[model samples]
Target chain A: MIEFLNSIQNSLIYKNFFLVLSGLDNTILLLLISLPVGFVLALLFALGRVSKIALLSRTIASYIFVIRGTPLLVQIYLIYFGLGSVKFIRESFLWYALKEPFWCGVIALTINTVAYGAEIFRGGIQSIEKSQVESGLSLGFGKFLLLRKIILPIALRKVLPSYGNELILMVKATSLVSLTTYMEMTGIARKIMAKTFAPVEAFIAAGILYLFLNFLMVQFVKYLEWKYNPHLRLNN
Target chain B: MFKFDKLVFGDAGWGDEFLIATLMTLLVSILSMGLGLFLAIITVWAKLIQNKITRFIANFYTTVIRGVPELLVIYLIFFGGNAVVMSIAKVFGYNKYIELNALTIATIAIAVISATYSSEVLRASYLTISKGQIEAARALGMNKFSIFFKVISPQVIRHALPGIGNVWQITLKDTSLISVTGLVEIMRQSRISSNVEHSPLTFLITAAILYLCLTTISSRVFKTLELNYSKGFST
Candidate 1:
């Protein structure tokens, strides 16, 4: 039985499975670093969309539209090869950060997800009943303070489910990091397939990893929604 | 700044190549979207069926397809499909290897992903039809097919227009990933031009402009459809 198990473990399928699994760290890192960065930017963009200044709101809306309309792959390529080729960018202080493929991947993923997450957040903010805002204003809360103390808390809860989908999308978008030569899960799978010519097995393993990660994210978001919305739970 | 002349029609320009690639992207996306709609109809039917196993399988299909990265799905279908076909051929006493066209593989991959989203949208649209309406149609002795055509489909299309528009936008962008499989779509053509010209920024930006155009036009078309469908309804 030990010999039989050893033979199974020593097979190419098992070897490639574990090899692809080893790259999960890069994938996780991309998701963790980009998501928080994206969340901050998304909140800002969402706020900008609803700002009193027409120019700021219009500019932010156009930024959201352009980003949404283009492909993430094109954006990734534009940041990496396109920006990297510019002599001005090379000489600038930003080059130190932009020179690396990992950072490029993070920047692309964060910016793309911000476009999506911002829209969701804007919807959440807009969905707040007008009467609630008026009551807060009548209670002597300043606009910024009202947003900080009252509006955001409620809006964030409303945005959780949609934001969860955006989170999953970012996780998927990270797979495109391979195009920039960064070794994430999909990158590792591609390498394994190239060397062994067994793309089926390699990609299947990678797909399973992605599916598992997304499942966890979905569950976590659901838990947050449940915990945050006590009123709905009590009513039920 | 790059020379604008290089983008114009000439032997030194990529205008013709870029135009061809744009058409390729449109063709592949349209075909896949049609396939996705067909698949979604079947998936929705399976989900709405009164059997536990079918529902479970349908649920599993959508969850897995939607949850996984589309690039991985593309890779899986391209390579895994070849393997599966080769193995099946071997079992049939055929020794030759089989090669599937990258475009077909890409269309199937994108269609599978699009179908999951389409199914969810279609299912939601179907649910919006009042149950009483269906029962009333049945009470009038209308068959399932007649009830679906006369009652359900029009409303579903009206309700599903926006969601389907969202799906089309996603599908259009996703055709970019098919470039990895060597389809000479806009993204792939742009990459080639960029590499040859050593001006990655210019080519990529141009590609982005073309993509933006495609999406903007389609969104307008979908808006028209939505307006036409919601004609009598108040805003």
Candidate 2:
């Protein structure tokens, strides 16, 4: 225990908080870009999954199955290393996107999250009664108007709890972006550890930062839940 | 673009190594699952004890571990574990440098992460057991051990099986992340084979297929267990 304390006192994590904080931008950037894109794609795929067309639903089902079945690390490696190794891909105009590890990490993270997020969205959408859609049509609401005014708003609210869980998971998952050699918080912690030989302190520093980030997120989700469900609040 | 012959056994191909590596991955995963369950039982016990400090500690373990990225946990164990272990060893009057094997390190790191999740499953399962059932068991003059063995455990196992199955799948997939510690698990082995064969696409897709099979098969197995345990009872 004393060793743990002494190591903390002697380490760079305590003395260099700003250096550790520097990696926060990359971590937040990855989340900001991927989460919205993933949610949008997830909603589209979830719609496809529930569509009347068998082929479209079946295709989306298989895609989600394969993506959810495999590890995100393998998916990341597949995008970063596997796709990059193909000769034509390397030589083609697509290399601009594939060459950067940050983009590769983003692509993999988005793909993986979309699969899980799609399932949540599907559940939320499915919970809505078919009567609601029919009623909207009877009232002369156009398809897109109905979606924007009713379907999306209700579905998004229904999925907020699960979406919050996914948000936390994704925040934690951004740490894996370090595997592609991207300088996220975890990657920065690794670099700092390598330089100072203080692995425990560096990791603790990173862990604390993630905990703080998720704490804020959880509170925001809680506030949203409270705001949107005033009837439930009144009952309590 | 495809070559099945490269997966042939013996020194002529990397197939044999891949098989062994797959087994290694399974071995680590199964070991970590068992260890995680043990820790989870203790964590749940601590929570149930109703002592403020113990409950707080248990909550801290689950919340902090779950919040942090798992890769960070593995990295801390891979590097910091050696020094911590050496220091404890020194207290036991050993002077030689003691390095933790990659297998042990991987198992411990993954087990710590797995325990936090499994504990949540288990605690909920325990909570699902009705308070009346325990009182009824006591009213029957059943001993504590007998009541726990007969009334509590059967219900807990049945309720918790599906959740544990999810945790088991997560643990299995999390093993691939430990490949960063230079363990010759399926992921690391795939990297080696891909580099040697210069066909990353083929090898990685093979790895993905292997994972898909493992997940599907194990999920089926969990389904069977759930069914059998649920046999004679209806909800």
Overall lDDT per candidate, in order of appearance: 0.92, 0.91
Clashing pairs in 1: none
DockQ winner among the candidates? 1
Error of 1 at B87 (Å): 3.8
Leading candidate by lDDT: 1
Per-residue C-alpha lDDT of model 2 across residues A106-157, encoded as one tens digit per residue:
8998998999999999999899988998999999999899888878888988
CA displacement after TM-score superposition, residue B119 of candidate 1 (Å): 0.4
The regions of model 1 sitting more than 4 angstroms off are A1-8, A234-236, B88-95
Candidate 2 — which residues are off by over 4 angstroms? A1-11, A130-142
Model 1, residue B225: distance off in Å is 0.4
Where is model 1 chain B poorest over a 10-residue stretch in terms of lDDT? B1-10
lDDT of candidate 1 over B110-193, digit per residue (tens): 999999999999999999999999999999999999998999999999999999999999999999999999999999999999
Q: What is the TM-score (0 to 1) of candidate 1?
A: 0.96
